[model samples]
Target chain A: MPLSRVRIVLIATSHPGNIGAAARAMKNMCLDKLVLVRPRLFPHEGATARASGAGELLENARCVDSLEEAVTGCRLVIGASARLRTITWPLMTPRETAQKVVSHYDETDVALVFGREHSGLTNEELDLCHYLVNIPTNPDFSSLNLAMAVQLLAYEVLLASEEVTPASQQGQLPAEVEKFEGFVQHLEQTLTDIDFSDPRKSDKLIRKLRRFFMRAAPDDEELNLLRGILSAAQGRKSMRRDETSKE
Target chain B: MPLSRVRIVLIATSHPGNIGAAARAMKNMCLDKLVLVRPRLFPHEGATARASGAGELLENARCVDSLEEAVTGCRLVIGASARLRTITWPLMTPRETAQKVVSHYDETDVALVFGREHSGLTNEELDLCHYLVNIPTNPDFSSLNLAMAVQLLAYEVLLASEEVTPASQQGQLPAEVEKFEGFVQHLEQTLTDIDFSDPRKSDKLIRKLRRFFMRAAPDDEELNLLRGILSAAQGRKSMRRDETSKE
Candidate 1:
């Protein structure tokens, strides 16, 4: 019933500041129970500065050497990751995981786990959970911080616990800005490579091209498919240009 | 139900980019309704520039002058602020606010209010809200960037809607990384509410706390339930602090 009871654990956090930020994130969402496993550098300056005033979470935090011990009694364990693995588990978003926890509100404890900043949760760590929580970033570059993963999951959990009967209109899910940006960047690079972009007007041309996609409002899956097509087109363009340039 | 249709309002924002970012934040959370009340700048070049692909939120954002007008028919109004004023509104943390808003989910409209970054809401403005949403931050410095405030509320709305349950569990349910970071920030705010974390030691404790929770690998529902408890506790603390300071 209280955010304080839901335990949140971080594993091998390298930067203390990120740890602080992660605490800040949980506190922002009203989650308080915190546990750490084998952190590299804790009780450091960056964290508190980053944590700002949400430092109380840090004071009561429990640190352990092993992840298994961190979540011993937990009825549900959600592993946060940037990438998907071959490991078999009920994959759930942080939101779904939160719902699972709520469904078992009868359970005494629940856990939301994250991994090191550099590599994220290991397969062994991810396998420990009943479900895998992924943040779904651009596949080409999906490195997310520990705190960020927590914040997203926390936000969803809060909403699920609410009483509102949603109007339930599935609005058009928009394209992710990061993914759109990535696709645009790739397209820009591709255009430049094909000599289709005149250096003088390339910036304007690229902006216009970006605008075209932005207007379309493609979501993640759509954006990915668009990028794939563009990449293929650009690849063909590259071959033709290379042949002509050599000749 | 679904998170796609939450109405997010920003009052008296100063920066256009923040507006743009707020739009991006809403999009990240899957909350598309963005209403602005007398932002210092809107249809702002910098804001749109920063919004990246969330231009649609900007394009569709409803601009108004009075807070009442922005939320006239709303069944619920939750205000965002880092500072507590002498006058009180029913206080709630962002997570609690999200829950409260959703409780009114059957209503045609729900508005989560955010004030300017500099001063937050005035007593008159707070009066218009059914609830006051306090973002717990560093006691010494608790000001969140306007976009960050928007991100927190938007993330909660989005999480409340769809992040909790995804059709597929193999990947993260399409939430933006930056928005997730905002939730982390709000989590940190909670410790500030407890007033136990000294500024000097705040950073270390906060990071350790993040380390603790991030390691838990919470799912969306678990994270929300945790945050909801913490946010409610902070809201009580925030209201209490305001009462004492006023006397």
Candidate 2:
């Protein structure tokens, strides 16, 4: 019952195979409920074969005449977006939106709606959602496959529902605050000692370094190893200073 | 040069529009490297139209006869998978996989290979990959549009390489391990106090809860609020226990 509460709605899907693929994507994530609005083709051989083992989901999919009818009675509606619209709406990242949907799983019916393969959701269709769900994609190449978007969002939903767990973190640990802070302090001191940055004017340099490390997201051992390198640099600088002073 | 080093290889793609769409997706993410292996049609009107502003990418796209030729010198090769096979290869989620690809960006060539529109990569073709990348999707319905997968993975590459910043995190910070672990311990204690899980046999439940929160990835403030809720629940449970003892 809760599974059915989370509905995957595809509007004006042009390719029957994609509709089947979308159904398969939903099924892969243990989602059975699918709603198709004005799809160009359904009950097609291509869709059935593409669905593979997920043909049952396609068989049970609700094909509606309109977006309005597809999402009727749904208390929470989320439209997946690709581009920034002329009219901006409240937008949540796919991860955040999936959590919201899963959290409200018991209380209300939720619709995760997708637009056509070519144009994506129209402004009018997007207006019906409580908020938009935008997958953080490459700005230069933001075109996502219709089924891939469904797969990503549905994966998040499955994850939020605690139906699945990632294999493991593979022994890599996230950098802790203390370790990260230590690395930053070590890097700053090394830079200052080496005259790479003047201590008094290192604010901007420090900010750049912070951004670099944050983007890299080094693990604990990696941070420790880097700190070792910085310490060695500091030692080398001090040794050079000693020689220059003696001369 | 690193951007050029990361190649998008489509093996035997069928539709001209998908090829165009794939090019658009690559351009949106700032990726210029595209290799088509034995596509059904190329230089078609439909592909040109779908490419839209990314015509430059399609113009420079390389058409190769074999996957080996497309990825000949790539030091790292990754294949995208929608289904599991008998022999499991080392798999990475799209996010982790993208991070790996980006980390190697400056050093050597990398390839992100996707299969055909109908039947995906064959076992023989997949053997060429160093590892497999699986986008977690609905187990029942794991159909992903090829271009969309490219977009999401390319987006991660951009993020990891610091080529682009997300629009914003809306003030939510990434959770440190200490904070995450603290929240987990609090949740487990509350669950125990409320008799939600038997204290002795709660290891599996606790593990599941951990996965749920980890996937949800609530920021520090959100974690604090959740911890507060757990504390309140524990307090209420203690009060109830005291009343029952008195009775």
- Chain B TM-score, one value per candidate, order as shown: 0.64, 0.64
Put down candidate 1 lDDT per residue, B61-121, tens digits, no spaces: 8889888899977777777767776664567777677776666677658888887767888
- The 0-to-1 C-alpha lDDT of every candidate, in the order given, reads 0.63, 0.71
Worst 10 residues of 2 chain A by lDDT: A238-247
Residue-level lDDT of model 1, residues A71-151, one tens digit each, is 876645667766666433446665566666555544347788888877877654653555667764433334544565676
DockQ of candidate 2 against the true complex: 0.10
Error of 2 at A72 (Å): 3.5
What is the i-RMS of every prediction? 27.8, 20.9
Error of 2 at B158 (Å): 4.1
DockQ for all models: 0.04, 0.10
Docking outcome class, model 1: incorrect
Which candidate number has the best lDDT?
2
- Across B155-188, the per-residue lDDT of candidate 2 in tens digits comes to 6676566644333322333354456667777876
As a whole number from 0 to 100, the lDDT of residue B185 in candidate 2 is 79
Return the TM-score for chain B, candidate 1. Answer: 0.64
